[model samples]
Target: MKVFVFLTLLACGAFAQQGPQCKAPNGGGLQPVLEEFVALIPTDKVLELVLTAMTSDPETQAVMEFLSSSEFYQVVDLVQSQPAFKSLLEFACSDLYLDAAYYFNILAGIFGFPEVHNQTRAAARTAGFRGLLLDILELIPVDELKALLDQKLKSDYYLQVAFQKINSDEFGSIIEALQGDAAYNNMKNRLRGLGVDVDLIIDTISKIFKP
Candidate 1:
């Protein structure tokens, strides 16, 4: 796993050297780099490696160490300092928030236990919080994101807290102001026009807000 992560980092470094403008459509895009990385290793092997590490305390500690190390920060700084990264970040920020909260669910699953959460948060602090976050904002497809989020939220306390916050009076007021009764009625009408059962949307929201 360490070898795999090291090689992956090396490959990313080499790829980033190509500068941001080489790929037109994505603008030095992450897709080709990710594809190349994926092609270099079999999925089964990768999964095996991940599972092995997850089962071994020493291996997990090694990973945690690497994550919080100065070397990792250097990599993060290099990535963030790149013009391509900045460009991609601007583009990502424009639409990223639509799905960004889903990642909290992912994190919550990984660090849901207080012991794990404290350890991970401490590591993140050592690694520099902003740098750690900016380094991992790559997007997944919406459907896949939703699926992962759904699975993670099943055992995620942080996600529950986040959802509760969204349902709280402060956030509710914001939501209400943004889409009050008239707007919701209009949305229901629009959905009905598109042959969608508006009740389904309402029911979903009702479940989300249920005490």
Candidate 2:
């Protein structure tokens, strides 16, 4: 009996030394909580809340803080895995995020998406920043996005920058990863199909998205 007990103890010790099986730290186990937080806010209300938090909250000076935070993005990715969550993000952002694309600058630290920063823009290019605002361009208004695009068309510098971002340029491969989710997945084109006039905005994006 004593020998058996000793052997059991040794086995337990070995297992402990092997360490707890790592779960890959997906969202640090906080995706559900973040999903809940997003669910509570209505689609139209999301922008309002972000704007409010940005304007009123001392801890977070801007919605861009939440949008670009890698931690926050992690949470968003996990929640986005759920169809319901993805649906909400897509619908809400269509009316809000795209319209508010000019505010991306405040979140660039979190939005750089370096993984595909060096990659070339895909043919359809339906993904990777379609409607998703970059950290640099998110801060400006639609009007500015248009003006910048206009300036770049004339100079050529802005066009290259936009190309780089679409093809492969950032660390997180943010452009690529964003394509996996709602903002860049398919909605931008849908909006255009709905007659949103995105090209007009792209023309301006060149000027404002300044590298």
Please name the candidate that would achieve the greatest TM-score relative to the true structure: 1
Q: What is the lDDT of residue 28 in candidate 2?
A: 21
TM-score of each: 0.26, 0.23
Name the runs in model 2 displaced over 4 angstroms. Answer: 1-172, 180-183
What's the lDDT for candidate 2?
A: 0.33
Report, for every candidate in turn, its global Cα lDDT versus the true structure.
Answer: 0.34, 0.33
Candidate 1, which segments miss by more than 4 Å at Cα? Answer: 1-155, 181-184, 204-211
Q: Which lDDT tens digits does candidate 1 get at residues 1-211? A: 2212112222222212122222323322222333443354344544444444435434344554554465544444443344433333232223211121122123223433111110101122123322222222222132443444455446655444444444456444433443333533443354354343334434432332233
- Across 1-211, the per-residue lDDT of candidate 2 in tens digits comes to 2212111111111111122121112322112222232344343533544444445444334334444566556554453354443332232123111111112212322354211110001121121233322321243354543454455445554334323333443312332344455644354454354333455455443343334
Q: In terms of lDDT, which candidate is strongest?
A: 1
Against the true structure, candidate 2 reaches a TM-score of 0.23
